[model samples]
Target: MTRCLRRIAALALVLCPLAAAAPAAAQDSAAAEALFNRGLADMEAGRYETGCEAIAESHRIEPKLGALFTLAICESRSGRIAAAFTHFGEYLAQVDQLTPEQKSRQGERPKVARQEHDKLARLVPELSLALPPGAPAGTVVKRDGRVVDSAALGAGVPAEPGEHVVSTQAPGGPVWETRIQLAQGEKKRVELQVKDTSAPPAGGLSGRRAAMVVAGGVGAAGLVIGGITGALTLGKKSVVEEHCGSGIGVSDETACDQAGMDAADSASTTGLVSTIGFGVGLAGLGAAAVLYLTEPTQREPTAGATSRRIRAGVLAAGPQGVVLGASGVW
Candidate 1:
């Protein structure tokens, strides 16, 4: 019984690595096969983007000529000539001889892919990114989120004709980045540069100055509304006075009474609207003043920067029931 136990322990020890690796290996194989099947299905359905992504991911999981060829075909169908050309060339670069079964499945496809790739090279756009003489060492380049190696940088990198985001950074150094648009068959070179955040803000006002501008706008809008509502209130009051003024010289006293009551109700509504507008306008102008005072004094207005930028001015409306007013800057 002791010898039997000892043999079991030895077997466990001998198989430890295999036991640890089995789950991961199984997972990878299953994922690769699923992606490959999905890619083939999507390509057959003419879903170029989805098919390309699945095939590319399958190849990443386990490199295969069939996956690479499918990816190239999808890219071509999607109008990504540059990417298709590169992938097709890469597929042809695999010099390993295929088995009779494999060759039968993909007969003449290899020749056709290579022929299309050569023709595409002349018609595709490329982006050449070069660092200046003083770029910090250990600076790595990236396109979108993927690493672009030094070998790819020597010759221009082939890409789809559109906007591409390029980034570069060195260890402990600030990252430099930019976006460039490539036209079909155009070879464009871009030199990346770092951002300078130390300088004061540009283009438009910043901090409280910006707030002041916005507050001024709000104040102006409030003033306009207040004015309209104030006019309505006055018109309603005039209407009430005309129809029934002490019931003197008004024919049909009962009709005058009804008209007066209706006008009074309308006047009440307009009065409320006017009061709200005037209050909002006042608050907006007050906010503009506060924003102007609290603005950063350190930022001296750069050249061509206007100080007032049309600061808040006055707009007054008649009383809703009591006193009413609106102040603003145009």
Candidate 2:
């Protein structure tokens, strides 16, 4: 019994390392696979920051070609095209050991890399238009008093390296203006403030008095016509009632009929004239209100400026639309 006990003790001692190592190894493999999957999920969702973190963790645990390839893709999608190309090249250097299917997948990488490279090549010297918070979308962007493409609001737009005036305007707002200087391969952001000039000036009388006078005249004319029409209608009703009273019969109706016809014609003409006058008056009043409301409260043109630039070969954040950066001479 003592001999049997000694043998069992020895066996336990010998197997202890394998028993402990098995669980640790399994945990590490599982963690690595989980991180890798999360990285792919992030890349697919366009959450590049999370994707980068996950891919980096997966690479740290196990250096695999697939992980590196995914990392490259994540970098490219995150606007780090140069780094993506480098990592893709590194993946290709290890392509010899891959199976036929893996080689086929690997073969497609270069083509994708090349396309990204081309896109990057065309994406230098971008200009960014910074908009104030709550600025209306679809506002017109202008430069040097001329309209420029509003497409830059999406992302960075390629522009020549130089100084330029930038401005934006919307309906019922004052024009916003600023100046910025751009360097070769530099990405510059220009913030524009949209002004609101849709209020009338104070002091009860200024700038819009003439329009108001005209509108008042038109309104008064309408009221007078309406009053005249109402009076005429009342008179016609009285005359008709008098002539068509209880004792008047159809055979005794010649003068009554003539009087009734004249009254009817007068009432119809007055009603038509009143309606035209009222419609014209309402239109004039509306036009006057629009003119008064949209008049500029203050004529002073105020401007403020702030700018940021990113050179080519550098990564930068941009609002949606075109992506641009300055490139070094290749």
Candidate 3:
């Protein structure tokens, strides 16, 4: 009898706790449902913030798929389309496990989610841009006064669909701005004239001309010095030959020797001057050549602004325009 009583007591001990906890679990579920219902009521009353908070709190307790779907609806009505779309996708994924009645109740939720996503997609603005020749690649492109992506500055980026302001700027170039209307899936080309901030200063040509004139003057001076030295060398050579030749008699030897010595001194002086003048002239010519070769090339001003376009997933050339891309757009 004692054994039977002991067995019965053990069974009761185990079952009693479960029985006691069952009502507590039910109460918790009821509380979660109450919060969810309150959230729905708040959302219907246009109190989106309160509704979302309450729904989120209910999800923390019970994690019901229906509560998540209701929160997504609230997000969509509150202009949080991206977040709404994400939640809606999650809700549809979970609805597969619901009963037949529940499934019927949520029949059109997926369709509504897609429609909301499409509506947000339409809000993306279109962009058109012009780029100058020689503009650096990876320039930033902006649309509707906001940065799209610098990578959108070139070929392969699909045309933006809508009306928007388009602009572009390089590291040192003037900003180019224009407005464009793009149809759905229609590509339009635009050109923007950007002034070259990299152009040389206005005095660049005048400075080059002045340098050329200075070089010419130095060349003329060297030539004149060389001519004088050549004349002196010729005169010295003739004097030396006439005085030291075999035609001279013994009495005239001393005078002839003196004349020879004078001529040799003059020849040495002339040779040294000639060498110096020749070296100077060569150096001046080399300087002039270097100056001419190293001078910056002149560029002609373009009539209009430079522009580029975005096509495909990259920035691409538009009809009659160039394309560019970069790390960012602004």
Q: Which stretches of candidate 3 lie over 4 Å from their true place?
A: 98-102, 105-107, 117-330
lDDT of prediction 3: 0.65
Q: What is the clash count of model 3?
A: 30
lDDT, model 3, position 191: 48
Error of 1 at 119 (Å): 2.4
lDDT tens per residue, model 2, 207-267: 4676666766775776677677767777777776666533256655434666676776776
Number of the top lDDT candidate: 1
Model 1 TM-score relative to the real fold: 0.49
Worst 10 residues of 2 by lDDT: 313-322
TM-score rank order: 1, 3, 2
The models' CA-based lDDT, in order, is: 0.73, 0.66, 0.65
| TM of each candidate vs. truth | 0.49, 0.31, 0.35
* Cα shift from native, residue 310, model 3 (Å): 30
Candidate 2 vs candidate 3: the TM-score winner is: 3
Give the least accurate 10-residue stretch of model 1, judged by summed lDDT: 296-305
